[model samples]
Target: MTPALPRFPHGPGSRYTARAAFSRTRPNRQVRNINLAPLVQRLTERDQWLAWMLHEHRVLTTQQIARLTFPSIRTAQRRLRILYEYALLDSFRPLVQSGSSPEHYTLGPAGAAFLAAQAGCDTAELGWRPSHTGRIAYSPALGHDLGTNELLTLLAARARTTPAQLPLWLSERSCVRRWGDLVRPDAYAHWCDDGWREMPFFLEYDTGSENVARVEAKLASYAAFTAATGTRPALLFHTRTASREAALRRRLAEPARNLDLHVATASADFTTDTPWGPWWLPLHTPTRRLPLAELASRWPELSPAYRPQASDDADSALGLPVPPLPPSDQASRP
Candidate 1:
């Protein structure tokens, strides 16, 4: 919904090679026409939402789409196959070393056309190019993008069954528009349980490729952000391993304490522990890990610095990204 993750919660994984292959485009795909009425009439609300979501994220694995929007993986696959058939989506499965990866999807020509028409703007304004999917397939950052989206999509999945909701999730692009000068959070978000407490945090999804000093150095900007905004949102570091987490925690403890910043550390295993469990190790209490919701309580004054512009039940007139999950009206459908 917002610009694609400049960086989001993720870790390193398989790299797509120049020699890699992708799922072939369906031979019977429909051609785009100047008139989009027929195309618009044919799509379900879910289908249209998925297309916008793809445009926002640039690409999404089948598993991510399923968890973020559908009732089940089976239903997601069935519906996505139809979208591909009509050229509403374009997909490719990476040629991995062992077992195959879930197919990855990017916004297709028809989808791009539909969204542009809806916004009453040009596709170029949407930042889409004819070679969108092709570029994504060959980019070195493919693994990192998928990994970052994976973290939030998993959180979206868990929130699906519970009362919790993600009120605002700003992509790296949106983060830059708002906080670029002061901080470099890969993404910024507000997680809340309906009518209760909200936890706003700057997400730093690490791949463990940098030196500890490089990681520690980023804290200075976070310190600057706090001083400027008069709001103290938590800064979370999601890295790749226990060892990486340990090294970061040790190095960050002093700087974080000195700045009086609230920093927490976790790793790849967090997805397995389901993010809500006791996986987060705050720099202040490195010895004990606590659940995520508990972190909100640590700062009784925790409120998002800026409220999201979109209402819970309606789209923005100026086109803000929709909720991370689909509309509640579509939540129960197959």
Candidate 2:
């Protein structure tokens, strides 16, 4: 029974033996594959485009990308997922109406790289435009803009009329630091004494649509500003809206009285008088082309009076005590 060739071993002509032989050699025939970095690099480029798109735009949804002119919707969506997988994009899925998807994406590190690489691309270039209003004209650190230039011109002109007018105290645009929750007033001025002293005044440009809550918050901000700098700053609110202007005046008068601080309003027309020492004074901004210089001309007198000292001796520079800031928030000057 053991003889007779093991009963023709399954399939025809010993196919079973042939398969076993091939299986034993198959392990030796295997080839090793390497070089995954190039594949990863190619994937990264796709993610880079998605990142760039997100970095430049605001609150874009998946559906929005499908309709954009640059990339086909499917491609955009696929690429966005790649970016998400790579952590190059940050996504937020807010709760909305039932059946509504609240997914939104923004640029992450990879997106920022794409933004930097694409010359002159920033939050502004991506269509997140800030209105021209509320922009500061000049700060030595933040640099000068039209608003800063205009304000300086007005300040320079006003200094010339006073019998006790001091020289124009000027802090150039570069002197302030820029960062964090800190704010540097648009300009630091003085009744120009040769000391180039700092009369702490913060100029805020408001373009209306700012509500009561905003005003209150800003009042708190003023309180914070004074606390950080150790000086009572005159907040010069500028606005084109008459209603907002009037409301600001009313709000400031009450809170300022409570806090023993001063907040005033002005307009671009230069005709609106700025209040001084609780007395409404008709102020004039000089018409000269070189206003700061004209303001500086009086520097001999003004700088000496308003000059800032590092002595850490004086209690209050503005002659009024600043209200203590709230416990949770601290103000810092930049």
TM-score of candidate 2 relative to the true fold: 0.33
lDDT of 2 at 148: 41
Query: Which parts of model 1 have CA positions greater than 4 angstroms off?
Result: 1-21, 27-35, 193-196, 310-319, 329-334
C-alpha TM-score for every candidate: 0.86, 0.33
Give model 2 RMSD, 1 decimal: 26.1
Per-residue lDDT of 161 in model 2: 36
The sequence of per-residue lDDT tens digits that candidate 2 reaches over residues 193-236 is: 22233333455555443465576566665566556656554455
Cα lDDT of model 1 by residue, 298-324, tens digit:
767665655664372244211465567
Clashes of 2: 30
Clash count list over all predictions? 1, 30
Query: Model 1 reaches what TM-score against the true structure?
Result: 0.86
Which candidate ranks first by TM-score, i.e. highest?
Answer: 1
